[model samples]
Target: MAENTKIEWCDHTFNPWMGCTKVSPGCAHCYAETRMDKRLHKVRWGKGQPRQRTGVANWKLPLKWDGEAQKATGAFDESFFNQAKLSQKRPRVFCASLADWLDHEVPTQWRVDLLNLIEQTHNLDWLLLSKRPESWSARLHEAMGGGSELARRWLNGEPPANIWVGTTVENQLLADERIPALLRIPANVRFLSCEPLLGPVNLSAIPTGEGHGLNEAFPRITMNPLRRALRDAPHVHWVITGGESGPNARPMHQDWARSLRDQCAAASVPFLFKQWGEWRPADDRDSDRPHWVGIPDGSEEDFSDSPMVRVGKKAAGRLLDAVEHNEFPQP
Candidate 1:
């Protein structure tokens, strides 16, 4: 429906369909599943569940947005283009927050239609994030094989300018697993969403050393003299890292977020810290307020030694090292 979203990274959220199965640890407390399945009962969420496509009216919303964008930029003088890039002026649409666009179980025709819709929306930037990046090429090939010029460009490894592909990477393990898959696909802007970040991640180096046959499987992800993962030029254009929110939200270590910010800075890539989630540092002034301690009363680790506090999502807010990082990659 092209609804305005509270998500900090995107201007709007559009789902061609509803419903998705849990694929990783990040899906343990998925807000979409909770809202769509548990409360609204719109669709069941699981491996065998049926995916429900949204109404035709919802599908046409992007066309209206693209029309608005065209009107905004159509008459702009050359001076405006010289000052700011066209992508910075356009609104970004998070393609599918409620479902994965690359889900294997979703009807092929639905994905094909969505791709067509994306192709038609010339002025709108579509952010397509998926958990199953490994299936992107196959699913995209199937969708594009249906007489789409955009498909030809994509098959040729030249993705459309408006399409920004990313994958959800919650930890180092997932970072290694999914990122290589995403890097294989050629895209205008490639990114990583480390939301609900469970553990520390080194973007520049692969800790496993094994790389799961990375030398042969993914030649693009190579280790240089500095032991930098990926290429020397930083193939990942942007990085968005944040903690978990909602009930049972896990606490993210302060150093975890800091390390990512530092890595992005060194690589000269755009880094965006979305939120601190429901947990904040225990040493903050807000800790004086009544809140649940991050650790249990009697656990192997002492609660007093815990470095985080459950101050609720609103009060916790989105600040890393006392700085609000709201950076975006230029499309």
Candidate 2:
């Protein structure tokens, strides 16, 4: 768990466990998977042994964060949350930074326990994102309230108000496949992360703002929500876009990010441009460059950074065409 983090969207990073399989292209240069191979050598990456949970201290962090956040909001005691006496501030928690909560391999009991913790932490907004939407219906439904959906149904939404569920989409396929499934659940807030983005994702239907453009082309994905309160209000409340980081990072096309920005803007969804990954728009040059190089076009050159330069995540920054899109869903 993190008390301080560099990820702009959320506050703390809580890890229920640390491991997962490489099921999609977004998993190509997965920082978590790579770290498993290098840093946490005791645990291996892949299907059989993806990762293990940390000690209980790490597990109880959200409670501590909730209390502190409540104290800051002048909600110092059990008065807690009522119409007029609610805590002024709620700390945002990015749950499972190192593992997918939806991963079928993670014991159902772990998820049930984690859900219990989330319920106890009254003043924290938990963000539980996953790459495995395919497993959501089965795993989530199965783990409901001591293996019974009764307690979950007692609440209006399946998850409590503090929890915001999301799915990761690196390309069109995931966006298409996952969006509909995600929409089927009334998770309060639903979002999409297009990091390590791999190709043209026509998220004209389900919308998020950004992620890395892809290395190879794939069939485009098309999807929609069950409905947006009669198709008027925003369905996908938030969108985060960025490029790949690390040594083998890939470049995201400017147009790809721009297209998403436009889509989010149209849908009235909050759009956050995370970063340009290891690539940035090429600066003006005296000599002409190849069509494949210099700031990418998402085509021509997939490997070499012709016009785009390897400026790294820091230097490249999170600006899309020099504009920093730091939108978030209103809490």
Candidate 3:
């Protein structure tokens, strides 16, 4: 468990279990897959690959972090001028970065344990993201029926307040396929991670009828477990966008990130432009801003027509068209 993580979106990353398969184009250059093979010295690709379960000690790490988060909030409170913000400060935890909470192939007991862990860590918001949003809904329902009362709350479509459920959409096809399924899950915060973005995604169409294939994408039944138990509308609350990273990272068009940022703004949803990864916009190439310092150069100019220079994620920073859109779901 890393108390401080390089993933700009969250405070800490806790993998209750690690290891996953390549399910889509987004998995073409998975950072976790490479780490498992080279650094971690773990299993090969595909299902049934060996995953080392994070035991009780690993599960208990966040309690220590909850204490650390309060202390760290002092500096933030002073800067933001928000008094006692620490009390409202819940450290966000990116859960199962190396595994899928929605993978039906994995043992149900493993998910059960992780769900139990999420219940215990009330001070941290767990980002439970998946490539397969459909399976997640099914798997989670199974866990709810057999586990504790807290788990039953999940069955009733009232998952723990601290868990942010989300899905990954690398391109428009996936954005159409996954986002609607994601909205079906009832969580305090519903989100999307459009990293390794391969094409322009029109998130503005997600609601109503504008989005491609969204008309019959998902049944409304996902909204209510008891058919009428819920009245509050859940949607794609937060969006974390970024280009690809690593050796063969793909070039995401500047327009792709821009379109998503616009949609988030219109909807009043949180939009976090995490990074540009291997490519930074051309204008940032000569900037003296500390954030743009020491960024590398790129080769592909045809990826986008309006000048997207590959200066890596660091120099590109988290700015979308010179504006930092770091919004998160409120309550």
Top candidate when judged by lDDT against the true structure: 1
Global lDDT of each candidate: 0.78, 0.69, 0.69
Decreasing TM-score order of the candidates: 1, 2, 3
Query: After superposition, which runs of candidate 3 have C-alpha atoms over 4 Å from their true positions?
Result: 67-88, 145-148, 207-232, 283-304
- Tens digits of per-residue lDDT, candidate 1, 1-331, equal 4698899988889999999999888988898899999999999999999999999999989988888987987844445433433267778899898999889989878887888898888777899999998898788778777666677789797777778889998887888788777766777678889998877787765432334554656434343211232454326788899988998787777777888999888767788999989987776575466544444211222234447878888888888878999888763
The TM-scores, one per candidate, come to: 0.86, 0.82, 0.79
RMSD of each: 4.3, 6.7, 7.3
lDDT of 2 by residue, 1-331 (tens): 4456678887789888878787887877778767766676746778987468778888877788877876777654454443322122566788776678888888778777887787777677788888886666677676774554433662335455667778887777688777766665566678888787666677656542222145235433433442352365336777888888998877887777887888777667788999988877676752353332433222333534435667668988988877899987764
Which stretches of candidate 2 lie above 4 Å from their native place? 76-88, 145-151, 154-157, 205-234, 285-306
Ten-residue region with minimum lDDT total, candidate 3: 221-230
Q: Tell me how candidate 1 scores on lDDT.
A: 0.78
Better of 1 and 2 by TM-score: 1
Indicate whether candidate 1 or candidate 3 has the larger lDDT.
1
Candidate 2 lDDT (Cα, 0 to 1): 0.69
